[model samples]
Target chain A: MNKSLNIDAQTVSVEANKTVEANNTVQAEKRLPGDLAMWFFILAELTVFAVLFIGFAVSEQLNVEMFVQGKAKLHQISGLINTLTLITSSFFVALALTQMHQGNGKQAAKLLVVAKLVACIYISVKIWEYLSLFEQGIDIETNTFFTLYFMITFFHLMHILLGMVILFFVAIKAAKNEYNASNISGFESGASYWHMVDLLWIILFPLIYVI
Target chain B: MQSTNANKKNTLSWLWLLILTVISTYIGSFLELFNTQKSLFIIIVLFIVFLKGQQIIDIFMELKKAPKLWRRLLFAYVILLPVIIGLIYLL
Candidate 1:
């Protein structure tokens, strides 16, 4: 009888350990940095950009001379400035997240405002570039190169605007101390989207302007 | 203390990214000025683009701390897109 009791006790102990281990696994599974939904959106955005890039490549291959000429007309200085501005803005946003995580909400908000201001510079420069192109009679209907150029860039610009809107709301919440280290999913989601915008530009700049 | 270390690392990454941007711009200008071996220049510039994308994914996006699968997928996106484009250009 004592042997049977000992066997039952061992079984119960093993079951309890198994439950504890399962609970630990559940806790560990929550370690992803941002909202799972945001990752899905990011994946979709990246896929679209990839397709557009491939399309651009195919078009360029078919019309290499025209593509070269169109690329030559682009303002390298303006492209470089915009690249720098976007990258700096990305840095600011990343820093803002760091500040928020450190419990410095106001500082985070200020950094985001700075990032927005830099984004404004990028937008203004882009507008000047578009006006220059328009003055030179280069529009979406100009050629396949310009068509792809304007379409891709303008689509990306819309994403930038959307990212700004997201950052604006994130900044407000951050200023109100809404995010903590453990509750930064919203902030991270916004940052992730903004970084996506930056990533697209990083690819677009060299592809369109330089190469 | 850990947060401060992270902040420092982020700052350094930002500075490195900026430097890479400047270097790529200089390379573009060099190619424009010399007009030599256009394919080679394209490859170099696109390589820079790939590096910048990776840095952003790893550092700015905080995928360094993310799951291994997420990191691999993102890295693949950054690397593969440029590689395919480079191949298309070369062909």
Candidate 2:
């Protein structure tokens, strides 16, 4: 009888352990998905944009007329179009990450290509806008507004180019199935950088063209 | 099946982001360009920006499940900067 009770207790303990393990898996703790270094880089990039944005705003306050006048010269439709393109491209990047997570690297590669194409529209529109401004005698020395406008938008455009290069590199690797369900840190890190670029533009749009 | 559901949710969030962008553009034009309702423009536009920024941070950046410190730091920047800019414009 003592032997029987010992076996029964051992069976109960084993069952309890299994249940605990199952629960632990089902309720896995949340974690950030990419490189910690990438997160720090994003933070640094955001801080730079924040400082520039604040400077632009404070300058706006000091010279409302110049800012308003400069903003008027800018094409609101171009701003709107660029905003739409960036956001759409960002959506595709997110979708690509999802595909990567599902072990569909080919699809993710295709999605990244699509995203880059969309971002190309933004590049085209912005360049045309700059050319038009130049035709109208607008330059960095045009006024405080144009000076900041040229400075800030030009800085942001460089970021978009850098992001495109990063995404391109990731997409090429993803096409070879380098990233999968178990290995996606590099892809996630690149995607995070792309998102950061989009985030900066979201704020820049209204700050420069609208209000 | 779970991945499909996640994709669906992301597409829905993308739709929301598009809607917010459209709304902000329309409002900005109506108020700032037309020079009508100027007083309310900054608040409304900045609020929309906050929503858009929050969505990108959560859904796109995938920072929603991150540690509280990182998520909160980004959130603070999105909110605080606009508040400061809006205050400067308003006052």
Candidate 3:
């Protein structure tokens, strides 16, 4: 059985290496078309987010009064600002992808830099918002809604950080002219991930602070 | 696959997203759409984001141009599983 398992592991590694090699060839061939694998990865990510969304929904339904009562104390203005920031950042990333497609690698990298800066600004504002809320004595222990609110938004924030990191890497790669119209999967994938992060914040900002 | 010129058209779409976010925030402050008024804002916000996200997926992600089966599978996996889980939890 152990020998069979070792064979299976070796086979899996071989398959993985073959996939990498094939994908690299596709990249080299400038056949940077979209693929099912990326979508499958995205679908998996969304499923995890959906679970948290469900948690928020169930908690709100279970303790409607407490949730609403807690929501009233939220800082809506800060939330709105953060939402705008994320949306604007997403716009930059999208624009960056377009620039990459136009063969303006330098400009594309600049746009990505802009996107990352905006993301950093958004994070700073969010940290401020979180701290101010804490100062107002609103913490996860406040109630179920606030607890879920903090958890979900903070969770999404981590994703934004990750997106920022990826964008930075893509920006550096673009600087080296590694991505162009013919080889843009990295840029496209990074933009897609950033937009997803922004879209999640779009949902979270209002759900936690505005409503 | 959009060029810079095509991106100009998309800027309007981004503006629309911004406007929607603001409008939803304003609406949430006043309206009660959910079962209770408390989470009405959150529900509305989620709806708006979901709508916008679908648009981005279809357009920016170019999912509409993808193979029909691939699109269907993608949507089913992302949308169906969580909904099923949520409903089961509710039940």
- Judging by TM-score against the true structure, name the best candidate: 2
- Note the DockQ of each predicted structure: 0.60, 0.74, 0.29
Q: What is the per-residue lDDT of model 3 for residues A1-211, given as tens digits with 9 covering 90 to 100?
A: 9999999999999999999999787556443234446556666777687678766767777787887787777778878888888888888887887778788889989998988888787899889978988999889897788778888888888889888888889899998998766678777777877876765665456546654
Query: Which wins on TM-score, candidate 1 or candidate 3?
Result: 1
Per-candidate Cα lDDT values, in order, are 0.90, 0.90, 0.72
Ranking by TM-score: 2, 1, 3
Q: Estimate each model's TM-score.
A: 0.89, 0.91, 0.77
Candidate 2 scores a chain A TM-score of: 0.89
| Local accuracy of candidate 2 as per-residue lDDT tens digits, B1-91 | 8678778867987899889888888888887566656869779999988999999989888888777788899999899989988988888
What is the per-residue lDDT of model 2 for residues A145-188, given as tens digits with 9 covering 90 to 100? Answer: 99899999999999999999999999999999988776899999
CAPRI-style quality class for the chain A–B interface of candidate 3:
acceptable
**Stretches > 4 Å off in candidate 2:** A1-29, B32-36
The DockQ leader among the candidates is 2
Error of 2 at B84 (Å): 1.1
